[model samples]
Structures are given as C-alpha cells and as structure tokens.
Target: MTRLVVVGAGLMGEAIFSGLLASGWAPADIVVSDARAERRAELSERYGVGSGEAVDAVADAQTVLLAVKPADVGGVLEEIGDRLAPDALLLSVCAGVALATLQAGVREGTPVVRAMPNTPARVGEAITAVSPGTHATDDHLAEVTEILGAVGRVITVAEKYQDSVTAVSGSGPAYVFLVAEAMIEGGVHVGLPRDVATELAVQTLFGSATLLRDTGDHPAILRENVTSPGGTTAAALRRLEDHGVRAAFLAAVEAARDRSLELG
Candidate 1:
C-alpha cells in the first residue's frame, strides 16, 4: 500500500523523508512528489522511493505530508487536496499557513494538521508543535505524532497558540546560532584562534543544552549554580544584562510572533 505521500522535496521535506527512512519506514510504502523534475529524480534515486506528480502521488495515499514553501502551499493544496481520500490525514509544516486554509483546500471531512517545526529537523533534534483541524480526530493526531516522531519530539497545542510556538521553537534555532556566533567572537577577542573558539562555543552549547534537558532545572537555577557570588561568570552575566541581551531576545521573539500572525 502507498501509505504516505510527501508533497515537497525541499530542505525540510527532505529532512522528514530522510528521517522516516532512518527510522525504518519502508521505501515502497512512501512516495514523494515535487514540481521540479530534478528534485523528484534526485530523491527517488537517493531514497529509492516512488516519485510522481502531486495529484498522482496522493491517490489512495493514507496520509499526505505537505512541506512546501508558504507561498506555494495553496497551489499544491489545490492540485491534490480534493483528490485526498476522505479518511486520509493532511499534515503540513508550512510556517504561517493555517488550519482553516488547509481545511478549506481539502475535501470535506479530510483531517488536517498544521505543524511548525524548526530547521533543527535536518539534524533530528527538532521540537514540533502540531494543531488539529476541525475534522481531525484523536487517531489522526496520533498518526501525525507517530510520523513526526521519526525526527524528534512532538507536542500538541491549540491552533490559537501556533504563532507563539513558531516564535519560540520554530525560529528558536536562529537565536541560539546568534548567541553561538557572539560567544565565538568573544572567545576570539580574548585571544583564542577562530577554529578553537568555534569548537569551544559549540561544545559549551551542546553540553549546556544536554544539562538543561537532563536535569530539567530552571535555567536561572542552573546559571546561579555556575555563578559564584562575584566571580568571572557573574561579571560576564552582569555585562550581558547591561547590554540588554535579555530584552533583545524578548523583543526578537515578539517580532517573530507578530510576523507569523501577519503571515497568517
């Protein structure tokens, strides 16, 4: 049976498909369709999955995963939405697209799910938030969860909260990268070689994130544990505070959230 049809072969689309294969999904059960013949051919050759046009790919497919660009979503939806099996699931990861839009594009009673997943999905550490549409049932949501789990953690939230989720986890990696860049530059300023500074910054970030996840301690608590009353860490922390780092992050997230709202 052609169980899943992926409707894009872009970066995030490729990531999800690759993750599914890595997690043991059979190639024969998956088919990918892309408007670009080159993309379709490349993925078919690389992953050994069936490739075809969007409408043909979704035919009899139990689930359709839409990973197209925000602007291209409507065209793809129009091409395949009505063709989807009534009981099939339509899971989308297009940022700024809404459940209402997805539902309107699809056949009546087709279950739709809108998800916001970050670029980290390329590395299998993504945190995705999924919102169910009006026709989606618990089983449909579970199916979406199971598919996304091939990449990383999944959370379910109300549709109303998706913009906030996009601001946080969806665009969160860029914020972390910006911090890493600054940290590396700081290290270089203090006389470390650029390569050495990059390694140090990357490892520190990886270790700190691991610590945070493993310990589940409040970030403030963890920072306090590192900062002795008036030590070097405290001095650095004070400098960062004085420089408005915290406020900048707050403003950045707000801006991202507002942009997402505008896009919707």
Candidate 2:
C-alpha cells in the first residue's frame, strides 16, 4: 500500500522504479513523472505503472522521489513547491544538491532525505549513502533505506560527509572503469588478443571483488596474499606505483569531493 511517485523516468529513476517493482511491489502502487511525453508513455506501459507530469504524480503518494538532474533539481522543486503533499516524505536521488537546498524549496518541516547512488545501481548492485535533513526522522531513514536497499546496500552518513560519498562511490564507477580499461590495454600490450584480454581483465576484476566480499578480509591483506616477493603481481604493482596510480586516485577523489561541494 505504499504509493510511490518518481519524478524523472530517466535511466537512474527507471532503474530504481524497476528494482522496486521487481522486488515484488505491485506495479499499480507506483507512479512516475517525466517532462518528455514519449518517455512518460513508454515507461508507464513498459512498467505497468502510472505516469504524468511532476506536479500531477504526487497526488496521494507516501514518498515522492526527486530524480531530476542536479542542474534541473532546483527548478523542479520550485515548480512543485506549492503542490507537493505536505506530509509525504521527499527522497532525492539527485547528486550534489544539498539537503538545505531541497528543504528550502519544499514546504517548511517537510521531511527530506538526500541520497547518493552510483551507476552500478542500474544493474541492482549499487552501494548508496544517505544523509538525513533536519526534519527527517528514524522512520524516514528506514523507509528511504528500504527504497534504496531494493537495488543495493545502504549506509547512513552525516550530511557533511555526503560530498565525500559523492567523490568516493558516487563517482567510483568511472574509476573502476578506468582501471579495467588500463588492464585491458596492458594485456594487449603484452600481446594478448582483444577478446581474450577483455575477458581476462573483466573476470579478474569480478573475481577480485567477489573475493573481497566473500572472505570479508581486508583488501590490503588480500593484495598481500597475492603479492609474493618479486612475483608477477608484485612486478606489476611496482610498475603501477612507479606510474603513481595510487597517488593519482587519491588526487582524483579529492578533486571530485571539492567539485561536489562547489555544486552544492
């Protein structure tokens, strides 16, 4: 009986809505809004859910999801400022839009939860971090977590740390992709065929992630386990160190965190 409304049926919004319905929530229990007429029509029929404009979908919903792009978020909030159900919880999936900004635009005392979810969420393997606004409560947190938990793990972080979350995991997928690209190129450099190189690199990345998750061991320890003295991994690691990969990653994450703050 949880009536949910999602604004913006774009990639991330669609992914979350699909994840919820696939997790056994009834299709009729949800609704979505998109500025594009074709998108609204397509998604509603495809998901067997309701669809309409942002101002129209929150009619009696328990939660209204703000999934608009960061750039458009303010305008959408301002547009619906007078119409949003006063008591319905507002859940934002737009990155870099701070809780204060959302709260200021919404009715005073309307509960708001700010969340940072990554690209992997599309495949149902995201790790999301949430931060509560002033009017949000324990019940609100649980509800937001349930919504996000459908697609992946959820963690509570202080609002102050949300920007860092944006840096680390929100933008983390690009970092992993870059690593995969480099690994594939490294394999090609070592004379392997493209398909074989891709397979090796991808499976290795997947297996390494699985190992960390399955064993619950420290990643550094796991790396140590594979890094025998003067072994292949050690040689490659040494080369990576010489190329300053670790330093570059640190600098990149820091830069992203700063940019997130600027956007907020």
How close is every model to the real structure, measured as TM-score?
Answer: 0.98, 0.97
User: Which regions of candidate 1 fall more than 4 Å away from where they truly are?
Assistant: none
Candidate 2 residue-wise lDDT, 1-264, digit = tens? 337999888888998989998899898889888999899999988989988788877756789999999999879987876677778999999999998899998899899999999988888999999999999999999999989988999999999999999999999999999989989998999999989999999999999998999999999999999999989999989989999989999999999999999999
lDDT of 1 at 176: 97
lDDT of each: 0.92, 0.91
Q: Which 10-residue window of candidate 2 scores lowest in summed lDDT?
A: 52-61
Model 2 bad stretches (over 4 Å): none
- Shift in Å, residue 260, candidate 2: 0.3
Count of backbone collisions in candidate 2? 0
Model 1, 66-96: lDDT tens digits are: 9998899888888887888767889999999
TM-score of 1: 0.98
